[model samples]
Target: MTGVTLAKAVKKYGDVQVIHDVDLSIRDGEFCVFVGPSGCGKSTLLRMIAGLEETSSGQIHIGDRDVTGLDAADRGVAMVFQSYALYPHMTVEENMGFGLKMNGHPKAAIKAKVDEASRILKLDDYLKRKPKALSGGQRQRVAIGRAIVRGPEVFLFDEPLSNLDAELRVDMRVEIARLHKEIGATMIYVTHDQVEAMTLADKIVVLRAGRVEQVGSPMDLYADPDNRFVAGFIGSPSMNFLKGQVAGGVIVVPALENRRVRTSVVLPKEGATVLVGIRPQHLTVEAGDSSLILELRERLGGVSYDYLRSSTGEKIIVETRGDEALPEGTAVTLDFDDTKAYFFDGQSEQRLR
Candidate 1:
């Protein structure tokens, strides 16, 4: 069964159309993540799914039921926002069971559900405390506990860990992952953080300016992006695009000696301008058949970044795990794994071969 489906989804705010036509399907029990930069419409899309925003055109389905026109509460989905919207006056147990009480659930049933959610979220000890007494992570967990008590068919999280510090964020991320595993419920998470998307998603939906750029597993998007935008967006430090020309069935870029260094990117004709992309981790400061000229290395503790200048003046970054020092002004030769290089048409910014 599909947990959610959006067909030709679009959103328009006055004269500006935010979301273009987007089609997506998330499978049952899968943890899907929607990720993009600010104002890219990821959060807008999530809100549309939650019934907080009306879609200008398209259909939204949750577990075989069409929810395009439904109210937020009628959609049978639970949402955890970035801010833990707990009532300051209410205790943790009261906040967790508030929705159930408002819906006229029996007191005993509400208590049972709250207790179960508290146990799952490690909030059993804080059940009597107000929101002011809890830490950021604990308060966020209470927000999540509120969702858990509803036992919805689907879970929607909009940057739920964004309020915590880095260490707490990591801890909450693990908790969310574990919660998904234990509940076996379909979840959709929205975030701008690439690390969160890469680590948590079973499938990633990459968005740009309200349009869907690519949808795939984390590694699939990382290893084989459909275009320059996706190739550049998926990894940390980003992929390096070196300016080169496609000639003689090979990609030719200049070496430090001003000689043409060739690689295995096949071209249909000679002298066709193309862009070559390689991940920072894929390049090494070692001489090989496919060497690039590296300069201006930056060291930051355990990780070091090498600034590489191609023959055509395109600058690329090469990241290494160890803190090895290389001369700043001296030219170092870098070898890229041919198998990892991505070829794109220079004009269209689209993947070629």
Candidate 2:
């Protein structure tokens, strides 16, 4: 296993900066995931780490070695691409041993490595099958096994599960989690899926438009977000943003009861026009006040209900247990639990209180 460090790493396509001096250190054997929307430069950053793409400036270190000028083959890092990149004509065993063969490893050694990888991935029965003969999940496993046979210090996965079906994706995700525990290799995964990042990562690095937005554990980013963008982005259905300001020690929302959405958090300053973010799960829907109108309800088993806040025309999804159904346009009370609410400064977008 190897720890990776990127110091002031910058990537630019001519003048367009794709990565803005990112400085990050990933610990040895840690499963770190880089997560963001499309065009966020996540893949570019991963390629840089793999040495498939060069950094515009700064340094990259793997374990104790400086590898900024190294080629992909010499970086001691194996990358599994989103496309799988398997040779269609080659059998699973051949594909897994291809890297070793190209590097001039002995046939017997290659066979041993392939056999070991096949056992780990449970692909022993499918060794002679070509890429076309295997299922999507199996093909992905071959791709992963290929990386495994290389015995790299660090592993890079660029949305390796994106091509699989929903059920297959879940299966592969569990498989990958198990693989990490079994191998204990340093892994850097890039994905746009929050569920993937949340479930797989030991630490998640959230990126946006060439900048690192936040880096933390899933619960840290979910429970205590650094900014409004992070607070909204990390959670499913997202947190609710209400237009409010501090008035006489109370967060005053004109739409709620008593013309105020009160909170216990002490305002850092007065006359601050801030956005009050309350997660959908944090809002209590009750038959108390009149302003809270339930626009829609999506009941998905015993987990929760997704209730759209009708009062503000904002899509608010509430998580509640049981088969409780609130009809569309049902007027109800919305209570923002003080302990769960987060205040954000309007201009800076920084979290307040």
Q: Rate the local accuracy (lDDT) of all candidates.
A: 0.87, 0.87
Query: Per-residue alpha-carbon lDDT of model 2 for 57-90, expressed as tens digits?
Result: 9999999999999998889999998898999989
lDDT of 1 by residue, 1-353 (tens): 24999999999999899999999999999999999999999999999999999999999999889999999989999999999999999999999999999999999999999999988888989999999999999999999999999989999999999989999999998999999888889999999998899999999999999999999999999988999999998999899887677656667765433334455544646787777788888877753333345567777888889887755567778787765566665556776667777888888888976
- TM-score of candidate 2 against the unseen true structure: 0.95
Alpha-carbon RMSD of each model: 2.7, 1.7
lDDT of 2: 0.87
Pairs that collide in candidate 2 are none
Error of 1 at 100 (Å): 1.3
